[model samples]
Target: MNMMVPPPSHSSLYYCFQILLALVLFSLQMLTHQLEASSSKVEVLPGFEGPLPFQLETGYVGLGETDDDMQVFYYFIKSENDPKKDPLMLWLTGGPGCSSFSGLVFQIGPVEFEIKEYNGSVPSLVLRPQSWTKLCSIIFVDLPLGTGFSYAKNLTAHRSDWKLVHHTHQFLRKWLIDHPEFLSNEFYFGADSYSGIPVPAIVQEISNGNEEGLQPSINLQGYLLGNPITTRREKNDQIPYAHGMGLISDELYKSLQKNCKEEYIDVDSRNELCLRDLEYFDECLSGINHFYILDSYCESDSPLWRRSLTHELKKSSSSHLTDTVPELSCRIYSSYLGRKWINNERVRKALHIREGTIGKWVRCYKTDFEYEISDSVEFHANLSKKGYRSLIYSGDHDILVPFMSTQAWIRALNYSIVDDWRLWFANGQVGGYTRTYSNRMTFATVKGSGHMAPEYTPEQCFSMFTKWISNLPL
Candidate 1:
């Protein structure tokens, strides 16, 4: 028996609605894919004259239980030389508050600010010849939220030390899930300055996660650090380092040793003699540039000086050079140019930065972040026992966290010296000195460089990094 059918007009209407539903679903899927792609896409940057010559992907990795609020921003640059086979390095810039862009544009990234002069417009970017991107793939990250373009929905998400380590470990695991292509690649954790307090723990966390059969295992290899602050107070060898650099007299040094009992930090407030010695010591070191002894201390007008003073103000409610004001140096002026360029709306849009997420893009974001972990020296020692390769480098001229202090901590590890101290050369000139230990650890110095070695000696740093990463002698 044949069933009664609807009229032709009704049948046509039903078919049309079905077709429209299908089309809508397809469009929604496409939109979802496009959004995902856009999150990791960077087509053009404002400062650059033309399209980006190399691959630069900017994105955010969601963190925490829900993976919705805490977003960590990152700039991933594929290796210009060999993206497929080159080792992948997670580069973290120190400050516990410094934006990773400082390392990206100023140190090892593909481009640098062309600050021949500042005309109030966006500072142009020039190709850096010695960028590390030529050798290995790098992910420059703005971590711990509240940094650069990274932010969290809740203000309490701002983390410190161990919490940072945990968050970073989770970030890497999720980041690899997003970009699975590099999951099997040789992975490394690297940082500079205050990162010394957290990097080792981060590495240890990764090692433990991998050992515990965590999802999307990372091919953990080793780590890199430059002028690291291994211990909170002990690593700050300012006075002794000053004496070695001839910034102080032997008499004053002896007085500090005798009165302060060789402990310069956290001295007894009741000891008037110790306080007097430290006062004299402070006076002697007042005019010196702690970051780079050789470089002239650019006065308050300098952006770098202002930034440093801002950090000092945040930490201690005062600054040593508050009364002194002088002319801006060219380097400091160039550094200031980066701030102007990054804060530009056009540049931010081109880089795919989220609107209203960050108010200002400063080199270092000053905040009251109390770190959970006091020190990470034990983490380094534990990592050493794990047989992972490690590189600890210092800028010899840096007084803030001097090479002598780094050496003293390494000595505390009691690792046998595999190779004694020797000069490492680049372009037929003695670039620096290096030493190797039995525990797969190497310590080196960049001669005439400041706290930020690559920023000061890009070519030499590139040479040193390329060789070190390749397991070759520097």
Candidate 2:
């Protein structure tokens, strides 16, 4: 996401974003803010072919306060464009526990894990040309602890969406204090997927602190989100999204719309028509990937037995390699490469991950975090009134948090349409459709993309991002 001082009342879905919840616990005085963060300059990575062309720093920032024993890890990449002038971004990945490293490599970072079958060595890396770092400095973070190399004294105790926002705000302020050189830079809060649950809340916290005249104030321009989950409507919109995409029949859709009132999830037990239609809907999407409907359904598991099967096949090195790993063609297999890479001791040492702090590093920590805030639309509504710019984009193919849900929330704000729905282009072809609102909020779609649209359509997203952030027409 970029911030190029967008035209007044125009927020084309390329510039910036944010999300939100309720409680604001910004007691800066209670926070024992420290300037000394344990960070390392990483010029070389184990799997990369040579020295990194861009600057990379890995470090730990105290979340709530110093001595809190909950360290949040972050990967800071200075903008390849111009750190002195480019906007700075605080990126949060979804899954609630998915490491922001996934955002760094799999989504918008300069480097990505080279996908290949395991040979017991380091998974190689390659550069991504469409990295968002090309536009601005990005701090990809592992929030709420227990993710990536971050550790917490009591992970079980910290299980709320509000806590993530609380700590994330602290993290941003503390990180800025440590690197005061970028204090004047335009800052944005950006995230995707489930993070849409907390990002707006964090943005609110920051806004609250800034208005209270907190020290080292953030220039806080705007925020951006991709395929964001704004409210519980995400569950209610899937059936319609499926129907619109031809994944379900018209008859089934009519039955659902009439009997369920378009609410497939949480249906009344006595509603037999709704129940019957839902079963058919489920059957229709049986093998479809909820994250991306077009892709073959693949379990995102790289279990020990699967690896053992790979090793057993290594005995011949020419066992056709077919069916050995059903996930080979799946995009998640690249995540498997990342899991192995981050867990390697040498890679850990190189990245300066504190030893003994965490167990095997996971791409996403599937924690049953307490869902304290079910609806964050209020946060967006609140931010919209504050006149902070925001860009909300969705991958048209994502059923998990359908674009329809995003549109519903945006409409809920009741802002006048400044720019009507129209297709935005990239490379002279349709990139996606966009609409701007009177509240400085813009919405857009990434054609044929799934969740985390940037991961699947980097160039188009970058094109969309650069244009909106630069205040250029999209």
Candidate 3:
């Protein structure tokens, strides 16, 4: 038997090499076909600012169902001031249904439009230049099969989380496949609420490369979560923490604090006072609206048009007709049209939420949303482990997905710190605080803002992104 084994060595090696070559050739054939179907051109233009040149172009992906493949409408805006100097940002909006284009126009786009007073109707809102687009090329994406102008070929394949992830994966994969050029750009993915899942999941998927040993790949630089809700278990545990932090109300806070203390049978921990203060702060948040947390609009002699239009902006009696939620208000004012301007059908179909339901309606067409807070925490952990950059910025007054939730999430990371945490002060206001964990995950808060932090404080958001893109070490 020993003599036989020695005799087979050279022949076995040659046979193995033949098999490997065949597998490699097969993979190359498959990838070449996929690449051929996906290739497209991206348009680049000189940026108004002297930054890198700017590029904007749209791309679509076919979901592959005989009946209906998902279609993604996406645009990549990149800065080209210096070929070696610009970064790429991928921006998605929450609602699992909201349009990223809406965010671009109303919140962080290159323009802002103000609603006119006196129901003037014609040219109701005037356009104002925004400051964020000056720094980075923003890629606005409409996803999940049914969001905005993006659509699926049929109804049967719609509204699945697995599909959501898969379709997005296919779309983005093809996008890069088409461009192939921007794959090396420093890229970050960010969105609010449910996008918390897709954004991180996609990143992890790309990193896995392929369990099937496929060759198509994505190179992601880092991740940024604006208001991510990843785990239900951790979310429930943190509810009290969220309440303690002023994201909810005192009554809700008191109930949870008492319940947790008794149930856990220990209240003397060093975190007790911090928990108590957090509870107290959160109690006040319940009263805050889903929109318009800014008190400036209510102050008399306020420079905002809302004040000028109201007989008593201070009197909570703002007109219901003209004063719908700020999001809708922006739409009406900008389009110079009535409810007709709102994308009602798309919103209803995409989010799985019925038309015209008030309150924070971010229902995903995926899972029942048992809480993926753990996944979010895990995402931050992995980023820190790989020595990559990440930023978690929250709106101080967002009644929906309160800033308190974000604070609790970070505290739970238990990361070791290089720099003792300190509040980041700006213009006499605590813009936010910076904490460097031994691993490099930095968490910050946007002072005096709501869920739409960038929309409210574009300059600060831009500054944060700019600094992050520089890849500066903590």
| Candidate models: Cα lDDT each | 0.79, 0.80, 0.52
Candidate 3 lDDT tens digits, 1-474: 456445667889999999999999999877545422332333321112232233445544555643124556665555535433456567877655555765665566653444544243222223334434555556677766556546555534565444555566666666666656666666566676556656667666655554444445555677787755554232333445445555567665666556454232233457565456444544454344443355333222122211111112112222222434344333223432322223334423322322332232221222221222235567666666666667777766654455665667677878777767677754456666666666666777777766667777765666665666676532
- Clash pairs detected, candidate 1: none
lDDT of 2: 0.80
Clashes of 2: 9
Give per-residue CA lDDT, model 1, range 1-474, as digits (tens): 999996679888999999999999999877554433335668678778888889999987767444446778889999998888899999998877777998899899999988666666778998999999898999998886777888787745566666678878988887888888998889998899888888999999999999999999999999999998777663237778888889889999999889888776666789888779887877776776666788776553222211232243233212211323223453555566777788889888888887777887766655656667767789989999999999999999987678988998898999999899999988888889999999999999999998889988987898899999998999
Candidates 1 and 3, the one with greater TM-score: 1
The reply for model 3, stretches above 4 Å from the true place, is 1-55, 65-68, 83-85, 117-132, 210-216, 233-256, 259-287, 295-375, 425-430
Residue-level lDDT tens digits of model 2 in 291-407:
677777665321111122112112211222223354578777776677778888999999988777787676666565667777789999899989999999999998777888899
TM-score for every candidate vs. truth?
A: 0.88, 0.86, 0.64
Lowest lDDT block of 10, candidate 1: 301-310
Which regions of candidate 1 are displaced past 4 Å?
1-38, 65-68, 300-330
CA RMSD per model (angstroms)? 4.8, 16.0, 14.4
